[model samples]
Target: MPDTLEPVRIASKIMKINHAGEFGAINIYRAQIMVARLFSPQLVATLEDFLSHEQKHLEIFGRILQSRGIARCKSFWLCGIGGFCLGLITALMGRAGIMTCTAAVETVVTHHLLAQLASLEAENDSEAYQAVQSILSEVLEHQQHGIEQSKDSLLFKPVSAVVSCATSAVIWLGFQL
Candidate 1:
C-alpha cells in the first residue's frame, strides 16, 4: 500500500505541513509588521490581527501533532526563514507590495486547504475534517482582505503571480518532505 493512501498517515502529514505553514505565516506577518511600521503604520494593526490568527492555527495543528505523536514537518525552519525573507522583501516594497504578497499567499493556501479538507472527508477523518473546516472561513477572509487592499495597485498582478508560484512550490516541497 502507498504511504499516502493510509488515512492516519496522510492526515498526520497534512497536519505537519499545516503546522509548518502556520508558523511560516506568523513569521511572515511579523516581518511585514516590522518593516511596514516605517512606511505604513496603519497596516501594522491589520498585520497583527493576521499574525494572531496564524498563531491560533499553529497551536491547533501543534495540539493535533502532539496527540498523534507526530513530529512537525522537517521543512519547518525552511518555511520560517523563507517566509520571513519573503515578507521583508515585500514589505520593503511598501503597502501595495505587502498586500500583494498576502493575497498571493492566501490564494494558494485557501486552495490547498480546500484540497486537504476534501481528502480528509474522503478518509472519514472527522478530527482533521473539523480542524480544516474551522479555519477555512478565516483563511478566505484573509485572502479577501488582501485582494481588497491590493486591487488598486499596478503591481498587483505581476507580484501576485510570482508570489503565488513561490507559495505553490513551497507547499509542494512540504508535501514531498
Candidate 2:
C-alpha cells in the first residue's frame, strides 16, 4: 500500500475491530447480566450500566465506519458468540470470575486503543484520533471498575492472565482479517 493510504487502511481496520469489539462487549455483558440475576442480584445494575456504555461505543464506531465507507470486520459474529460464551462461563464461576474477565478484556482493549491513538497522532489523523479519544476514558473506567471488583478475590490474577491472553489473541486475529 502507498504511504498515504496506509494510515487510512489502519484507521479503517481499527474502527472495524473496535466496532466488533463493542458488539462482543455488549453480548458479554448481556450474558453476564442474565446469569448475575440468578446468583448476584446486586451486580445486575452495574452490569446493565456497562452494557449501555458498550452499546453507545458500538454506535460511535458504527458511525465512524459508515462515514469512512468501510465494512464491518469479518470477525463480528465470532466476537459476539465467543464473548457470550466467555461471559456465560465466567458468570457460572461467580462474581470474581465475571469481574476478572472484564478486567482482563478491558486491560487488553485499553492497551490497543492507546496504541491506536499513538499511531493516529503520529499520522496526524485528527478524525480518527478524535473518534478514539472520545471512548478512551470509558474504556479505562471499565478496566478500573473490573479491577476494583476483583480486588478481594483469590483467583483474580490467574483468571485475569488467562482471559487477557485470550483477549489479545482474539484482537490479533481480528486485525489480521
Candidate 3:
C-alpha cells in the first residue's frame, strides 16, 4: 500500500521510532528478568537472551541515526521509562503476563517494521531499509516465541489487547514527537 506520509519523512521517522523501540524492549526485558528471578526463575535465561537481541538492535539503529546525523527520537528515554514500568507490572502478574506483554508489543513492532520497510524502499533509503531488514528476523522470532508461550495463558486475550494498544499509541506518539 502507498503510504500517506512522504517517503523521506517516513524513512527518518522509522529509524527514530525503531531506535526508541529497541531501547524500550531492552528495558522491558531487563525488568522482566529482575522479576522473573523471583516469580519465574526458569524464564530468566530467555529474558536475558531477548535483552541481548534488543541491545544489538538498538546499536543497529543508533549507528544509523548517528551516521546520518538524524537526531534520536523525541521519545527515546520516555520509551525506556515506560517500558520498564510496563515490564515490572507485567512481570508481577507472572509468566503469562510476561509472555502477553512480549506478544503484544512485538505484534505492533512487526507491523510497524514491515510498513517502515515498504516506505524506506520507496524512498530508496537503502541504508535505513537494510538496517530495518537486518533486525526484522529476530523481532519476528520474538513475536513467535511470545505467541507460542502465551497460547495457554489465561491473561493472553485481555493483556495482549491492552498492551498492543499501548504499544501502538507509543509508536504513534513517537512520530508526532
Best of the candidates, lDDT: 3
Best of the two (1, 3) by lDDT: 3
lDDT scores in order: 0.89, 0.88, 0.90
Count of clashes, each model: 0, 0, 0
Candidate 1: regions farther than 4 A off: 1-8
Q: Look at candidate 1 and give me any clashing residue pairs.
A: none
Ranking by lDDT: 3, 1, 2
Worst 10 residues of 2 by lDDT: 1-10
TM-score of each: 0.95, 0.94, 0.96
Instruction: For residues 1-177, write the lDDT of model 1, one tens digit per residue.
Output: 122334557798889999999988998999999998899999999999999999999999999999999999999999999999999989998999999999999999988887887778889899988888888888988999999999899989999998999888888888889
Candidate 2, residue 110: the lDDT equals: 85
Q: For residues 44-113, what per-residue lDDT tens digits would candidate 2 score against the true structure?
A: 9989999999999999999989988999999999999989998998898899999988888999988888
Report clash pairs, candidate 3: none
Question: Local error of candidate 1 at 116, Å?
Answer: 0.5
Error of 1 at 80 (Å): 0.3
The better-scoring model by TM-score among 2 and 3 is 3
